[model samples]
Target: MSFIELVGLHKSYGRHTVLQGIDLQVQRHQVVTLIGASGSGKSTLLRCLNALEPIDAGEIRLDGDVVSGPGVDVNRLRRRVGMVFQSFNLFPHMTVLDNIALGPIRLLGAEPRTARDRARSLLERVNLAHRADYYPDQLSGGQQQRVAIVRTLAMDPDAVLLDEITSALDPELVAEVLNIVRELAADGMTMMLATHEMHFAREVSDLVVFLEQGQLLEQGPPEQVFGDPVEPRTREFLRQIVEAGRL
Candidate 1:
C-alpha cells in the first residue's frame, strides 16, 4: 500500500464544492507537487490529508490506517502530518526558539530543555540560529518562513503538507524559503506541496498533479506532465505559465 492514499474524495463548503472525486496515492520518501491556477483545490486537498478539513465523502489513509471522517483522532492525525501555510503562522509574542519548541514540549512530552535544544539545532540547519532570540515580527519574511518550517520539523512528522509556503514572501526572499524545502527533498522527507513556483515544482517533484476547478486533470512524473502532457488543459496551463515567464 502507498504511504498516503486518498480514495474517491469529495469536499464542499455548503454548495460550493472545492474537491471532487479525487484519488491519489503518495509513496514513502516521495515529493509530490500540486500545481494549477488559483482556487484549483490544491490547498483544500492538503488540508483534507491533514484532517484540517473534513471530507464530505470518501477516505484518506496514512500508513494503512484510515485518517479522514468523524471519530478519527484529529490531534493524532496532525502529529503525524504537519502542514505549513502561505502565511508564516508564528506566535508573535514568542521568540523563535519558543515557537519551535512549543509542540514538542506540550504535545510530544519532551522536556523543555530537550525541545529547545532540538529547536535550536533545526534553526541552525536553516541558518536561523542567530534569530532564535528574536520574535517573528523582528525577522524578515524568509527567516520567519524558515522558522515555521523548523517548527513543523521539530514534531518529527511522518509527512508534511506545505500550502503555498512562499506565496507571501517578497520576490528576493522567495529563494531563501524555497532552499529549505529543496534541502528537505534531498533528505528524503515525504512531502506534498501546493506551489506556484513552476520551475521549482518541476525540478523537485517526483510527481506533479494538476487540478482544475476541483478535479484532478492530470498527474504524472515531471518529465511526462510538464514535457509531454496528455490533456489539452494541461498543455494550455503550461503555455500560459511559459508566456508569463513563470516556467
Candidate 2:
C-alpha cells in the first residue's frame, strides 16, 4: 500500500471550487513535487493533507489511517503530518529553540528537556544551531524557514508537506534552504513539496505531479513529465515557465 494516498479529493471555499477529484499516491521515502500555475490549488492540496484546510469530498489516508473523511479525528490525524509554509510562520516572541520544541512538548508530551534536546538536534540537522537562541525577527529569511522546518520535524511526522517553503527567500538564500531539503531527501525523508523550482523538482523528485485549473493534468517520473511531456498542456506549461526562467 502507498504510504500516503489521496482519493478523489475535492475542496471548495463557499462557491469557489479549489480542488476537484484529485487522486495521488506517494510511496514510502519518495519525494513528490507538485507544480502548477498560481491559483491552481497546489497549496490548498498540501493544506488539506495537513488538515489545515478540510476537504469537502473524498478521502486522504496516511499509513492506512484516514486523515480526511467523515468521523475522522482531524487533530489526532494531524500529529502524523507536518507542514512548512512559504511564509515562515514562527512565533515572533519565541526563540528558535522554543519554536522547535513547542510542538513535541505540547503534542507528543515529551519532557521539556527532551524536547529541547530534540529541537537542538533538529536545528543542527538544518545547520542553524548557532541561531537557536535568536527570535524570528533577528534571523534571515532562510534561517527562519529552516527553523520552521526543524519545528515541524520535531514531531517526527510520517510525511512532511512543504508548500513553496523557499518562495519567500532571497534568490541567493533559496539555495541554502534547498540544500537542507536535498540533504533530507538523501536520507530518504518522505516529503511532498509544492514548488515553483522546476530544476530542483526535476532533479530531486521521484515523481512530479502537474496540476492546472485545479485538475491533475499529468504525473510521472521527472523525465517523462518534464523531459518529454505526453500532454500538450504539460508541454505548454513547461515551455512558459522555462521561457520565463521561473522553472
Candidate 3:
C-alpha cells in the first residue's frame, strides 16, 4: 500500500479552485517534490495534505488509513503528519531550544527534560546546537528555518509536508536550509515539498510532479520530468525555468 495517498483530491477557496481531481501516491521513505509556478496549487496541495485547508472533496490516506473527512481525529493525524511553512514561524521570545522542544512538551506530553534532550539531538542533526540558546531574532534566516524544521521533527512525524520552506531565505542562506532537507532525504524521511529549487528538487526527489493551473499535468522520476517532459505544458514550464537559470 502507498504510504501517503491522495485520491481525487479537490480544494478551493471561495470561487477559486486550487486543486482539481488530483491523484498521487507517495511510497514509504520516498521523497516527492511538487514543482510549478506560483498559483499552480503546489502550496495548496501541501496545505491540504496536512489539513491546514479543508478539502472540498475526496480523501487523504496515510498508511492506508483515511485521515481526512469529518469525525477524524485531526489531532492524532497531525501527530503523524507534520508541516513546515516558508516562514520560520518560531516564537520570537523563545530560545531555539524552547522553540523546538515546545511541541514535544506541550503536544506530545513529553517530560520537560526529555523534550529538551530531543530538541538538543535534533539541533545537533542540523548543526545548530551551538545556537540552541539563541532567540529567533539572534539567528539568521537560514538558522531559524532549520530550527523550525527541527521543531516539526521534534514531534517524530511519519511524513513531513514542506511548503516552499526555503523561499524566504537569502541566496546564500538557502543552501543551509536545503542541506537539512538533503540530510532528511538521506535518512529516508518520507516528505512532499513544494519548491522552485529545480536542481535541488531533481537531486532529492524520488518522484517529481509538475502542476499547472491547479492540475497534475505530469509526474514521473526526476530524470523523465526534468530531462524529457512529455507534456507540452510541462516542457514549456521547464524551459522557462531553465532559461531563467532556476533549473
Candidate 4:
C-alpha cells in the first residue's frame, strides 16, 4: 500500500464544498507537489491530510491505518504526520531552539536535553544553529520559517505536509526556505507540499498534482505534468505561470 492515501475525499465549510471526491496516493520517500491557482483546495487538502480539518466524507489512510473520522487519536496522528504552515507558527514566547524542541518533548516524551540536541542538529543542517537563542520575532521571515520546518522535523514524522510555506516570505527569503525543502527531498523525506513555486516544484517533485475549483484536474510525473500536460486546463495554468515568469 502507499504510505499515504486519500480516497474519495470530500470536505465542506457551511454550504461551500472545498474538496470533491478527491483521490491521491503518496509513496514513502517521495516528494509530491500540489499546484494550481489560489483557492484551488491545495491548502485544504494538506490540512485534511494532517487531520487539522476533518473530512466530511471518505477516508485518509496512512500505511493502511485509517487516520480520518471521529475517535481517531489526532494528537498521536500529528506526531507521525507533521505539518508546516506559511505563517511560521512558532511560539512567540519561545526561543528558536525551544520552539523546535517543544513538539518532541511534549508530544514524543523525549528528554528535554535530547529534544533540544535534536533541534540544534536540525538547525545546524539548515544553517540556523547560530539563531538558536533568538526569538521568532528577532529572526528574518526565512529564518522563522526554517525554524518551523525544523520543529516539524524534530518530531521525526513519517510524512510531512507543507502548506505554501514560502508564501509569507519576502522574495529574497523564499529561496533560503526552499533550499531546506530541497534538502529534505534529497534526504528521502516523504513530503506533500502545496506551492506556487512552479520551477522549484518541477525540479524537486517526483509527482505533481494540479487542482482547480476543489477538483484534482491532473496528476503525473513532473515532466509529464509540466512538459506536456494532457489536460487543456493544465496547459492554460502553465501558460499563465510562464507568462508570470514563475515557471
Q: What's the alpha carbon RMSD for model 3?
A: 0.7
* Residues 18-101, model 2: lDDT tens digits: 999999999999999999888999999999998888898999998887777678787676677788999998999999999989
Best by TM-score: 1
lDDT of 3 by residue, 5-76 (tens): 999999988999899999999999999999998999999999888888899899999999998989888888
Q: Which residue pairs does candidate 4 place in steric collision?
A: none
lDDT of 2 at 88: 92
Q: Candidate 2 vs. truth: CA RMSD?
A: 1.1
How many residue pairs clash (N, CA or C atoms closer than 3 angstroms) in each of the candidate models, in the order given?
A: 0, 0, 0, 0
What is the Cα-based lDDT of residue 163 in candidate 4?
94
Listed in order, each prediction's TM-score against the native is 0.99, 0.97, 0.98, 0.99
Please give the lDDT score for candidate 3. Answer: 0.93
Q: What TM-score does structure 1 among the candidates reach? A: 0.99
lDDT of 1 at 158: 92
Q: Best by lDDT, which number? A: 1
Worst 10 residues of 2 by lDDT: 69-78
lDDT per residue as tens, model 4, 8-118? 999999999999999999999999999999999999999999888989999999999999998999998998999999998889999999998888888889999999999
* CA-lDDT, candidates in order: 0.95, 0.90, 0.93, 0.94
Candidate 1 lDDT score at position 60: 96
lDDT-best of 2 and 3: 3
